[model samples]
Each structure stands twice: as structure tokens, then as C-alpha cells.
Target: MDEIVKQSLVKWPNVPSCTGWLLLDRRGNWRMRDEAAQASGAAGVAIRHEALLGFINRNYEVDERGQWFFQNGPQRVYVELGYTPWVVRLSVDVDSALALHDQGGGGFEPAAVFVDEDGGILFADRAQPARIAVLHDHDLEIFSDHATLADHDGSLSGEFHWNAQLALPLQGIRRDDVAARFGFVASPAALA
Candidate 1:
């Protein structure tokens, strides 16, 4: 992991989830990838970086420690790390929509979107801590987890970390829906 990513993970130890990096090529194909790992390294095994890449391409069965990387044709993306309990940070390059979900409360809710200094989009909400599910077109589920939004300044730059949990199943979304604007839903939960 990069120094900044590592630092962010250290800052927020409670959120265990995956991090993603997305890009859209001129071909009109959307590319997305993400990394998942255990926050405390106890719930499941941790996947090696290279192994995670292999699983993404081969569609291999992954244990809790495995990470994933994927590309929708011209769109090239990879999840360098599997699933963790911490937040998965993302750096988006365009104006995108995010869909969030609240698993604890059981349903999808509205979320907020912001731009970072790098021009990346940050989708988040702090009103309630909940499990989040993000979909681009009501079909492809790009990201999902239990996350808590943090305070953001106007800078819309730099990396921010939050506490999150990865508890969504991979098959939650279908694979054939047209790519639509993404949205986020939140369901608050009580922490033990």
C-alpha cells in the first residue's frame, strides 16, 4: 500500500473494508477495481497483493483474506488487496453518482457527494453510521460496506479515512443492467 493509504488505515482502525480506484476511458467503457483486507487481521485471512490480482481475472473463489480487481472490457481496474473491516478509500476522476445502503437499519438512503483536491469525487454521509452499497446503474454494484462518514473541509483534496465493515455478498447485484448514475444508502447500527 502507498504511504498515504497506510497512514489513513492507521488513523481509522475501526472501519474494515475495501479501497477502490476507478477510471473511465474514452472508449465509453467504465473501469473499476478495488482492494479488500482485514482491518484487525483476525476475522479472516489476509490476501497477498499478487494473489488478489489473480483471483480477479480468474474469478476464483476467495476466502475472507482475498482481494479482487476487475475490468469491464476497455475499462481497466483492479482490487490490489479482498475484504477488510476498515474503510475502502477511493479516488474518482469524474462527476459520478453514489448509492448508499444501511444494513443495520435495513434499507437504502441518500448520501452526499464532494470533490477532492485531486478532482476525485468523494461520496459520503455522516448523519448515521451504516452499511453502504454503491451501484452505477442499479446493476453493477461497485462498492459496499458498513461505513461512517467523516468531516470534510472545502479543500476536496487529500486522502480521508473512515471506519467501515465489509459484509455484503459478491452476488448482491446483477451483471446485465445498463450503467446508471450511482447512489448510496445508509442504515445505522450500534457498535459493540
Candidate 2:
């Protein structure tokens, strides 16, 4: 595994249960096979093991290079190239910083929270609607709104690309939790 993937796994053990490989092209673009992208929803996307604790609402945009920017209310979080595969995971951590990890189970920590199914959808194909995950941390009174899947055909290096948006409310986490640092991780698919 690449250092990126190893570091990511060590930092956040709950890798998103992706069905196929998610790739970042050399030009810093992110891509997944159409089938894989289609299968992976916001739920399947990776998240911060500790993020289920706060309130978060954010948006995202991806350039041709696959570089990503997350806008949460007035704040903007940037994910550099080569770290696209860990976007979902980072969303969770960002939420935790806001103190949204409230719900538990489903392979997440007990303090971790999730939104109702009606709030979002996971898109398996371009023709499908995007999936969303809402998480909350009751003790911290934090909530997060996240979208994990999207379709991007534009290639930065003749490869596919993908991006997403995540939002969080600073009020959700403790007032002291505002300066939480964010990071990324990428895990390679296991061989069959």
C-alpha cells in the first residue's frame, strides 16, 4: 500500500466500505470506474471515526485536477491532490471537530451519529441521485450534512475524477472545538 493509504488507515480505521477502487489521476483529479462510483454512496464513503459528534453543513467543488474544497458555512477546507480517496473520511473528522458524532453503530463509534435515510441518497451511477449522510453527536449537540458520491468525467490526466461537499455548524461542537485540524487517508482495494 502507498504511504497515503497506510497513513489514512492508521489515522482513521473505519475506511468507507467502497465496492471498487477510487483513484486520483496524476494531474490531481479523482476518478472511480463508473460501476464503482455508482455502487459507492455517501454511506459507503469513508468518514472520520470520531465525527459522529457535531453539527455540520458544507458544500464542495472539484477542478479538473481533482483538487477539492469543502465549504462549511463561512469556512473553507481544502483537500490537496493525491488525497481524494480520503475525502469521505475527512468529512467525518471535520464533523467531529464541530462536535457532531452522536449516533452510534453501523461500523461507527458509539458517539458517532448518522442522519435519517430521507435526508440523502447514495448515487451508484450518473443517472441516479446522490446519496447523503447526516450525523449528529447529542452530548456535543453537533450535526453534519454530507454528500459522498458524484459524477465527474473531466480528466486532468486522461483519468476519471470525483468530488463531494460537506457542511458543519460550529455551534454544534463545543465552542473550544472550533480549531480542529483536518487530514486525509486513502486505502487500496484488496485483491480478490
Candidate 3:
């Protein structure tokens, strides 16, 4: 959390939280939902301001109820998730090995891998399984290069080789069951 935001919280501790006004899209963009866009059920305009993005990222956190929000100074601006709480990009690090990084620019060490019916890849955090991360679409080819697939009992199964020695097994998962299976709420406003 930012020191300024902490000071604001102390100065005004009773500020009500705002929900459904911001969204973290599947592609890792922070979108600002206007009233018109919300009423029409459309994805809001992408926020491209670097400084604002940095501020939001610095204060982004999850509540005890598993709701992710950005503490905008004093008020908590709840975020609507497009997919999982995190969106990770796959890249080859300097050692020519697979690496995962979350949208917030944090390193993600995945302990489990899941593949949806649509072939979308999701990774579960090594320390916290509930903290799921979807692989950015642009990196699918990189993921494929490190994965080996096969048919097992009429279902798809695979292994993601992060390096020569570490292999994470990929399990089949349905798109609709992702949120429930992973213990995350896609729309915090609806639940709030």
C-alpha cells in the first residue's frame, strides 16, 4: 500500500467503497467503467495513464472476503474481474527457461496448471492455490512450446516443462467452473 493512501485512510476512515466502476480485463488492462458503459454491460475504456496505473497497482489488494480492490486514497474501489484475479504473461528468461509474471509486474511461481475447454491456460500460485492467473493470450505459443499433450481416458492431459527438471502437470478444467473451482468471484459487486 502507498504511504499516501495509508495517510488518507487514517484521515478519513469512513469512506464508502465503490464497486463496479473499475475492471481488470482478461488481457491485463485496467478499465474505467462509466455509468453508460455499466448500464449497457460493456467493457469500459482502457486506462492508459502510466502514473495512474502505477498507483492502482501499488495499492491493489484483496479483502478478507476475497474481494480485490484498489484503495484510491481513502475509498476502496472494488474491481470486477474479467477472468482470474491475475493475468500472467509467459516469457523466456535470460536462462532460456519459461517464466511467469503477473499483470502487476510481480513474479508468479505456478504450482499447478489448468487448461480450459477452449485451450486457455491458467496457473495457480505456488504458495496460494486460490490466487489463480490466466496466461496472456499472446503467449500461448510460448506455452505450447514448453508443453506436451496427450489424451487420457477421453480427456486432455499435459505437462508444462518449466525447465529441464521441473514439470507441472496440466489438468482439464471447464471454463464455467473456473471461478468456483478456484474460489474467486468474477463480479464482486453482485456479491457485495
Best by TM-score: 3
lDDT of 1 by residue, 1-192 (tens): 334434654666555433334222212122342333223322233233664444333331122222222322222233322111112233222544333332112224334433323332323344344222232232222332222233346332222222222222122122121111221101011110
Per-candidate total of colliding backbone pairs: 38, 40, 0
lDDT of 3 at 182: 74
Ranking by TM-score: 3, 1, 2
Q: Candidates' TM-scores?
A: 0.19, 0.18, 0.94
In candidate 3, what are the lDDT values of residues 1-192, reduced to their tens digit? 999999999999999999999999999999999999889988899999999999999999988777889999999999999998899999998888777889889999888899888778999986654578999999999988888988766666879998777889998899899888877778888976
Tens digit of lDDT per residue, candidate 2, span 1-192? 234444655666654333233343322223334555535521123334343212211133332333343332333233322322221222234433321111222122122222212321111111122212222222211122322232334211111112222221111222122112111222223211
The prediction achieving the highest lDDT against the true structure is 3
Candidate 2 ranges beyond 4 A from true positions:
1-58, 63-66, 83-192
Kindly report which residue stretches of model 3 are placed more than 4 angstroms away from their true locations once superposed. 151-155
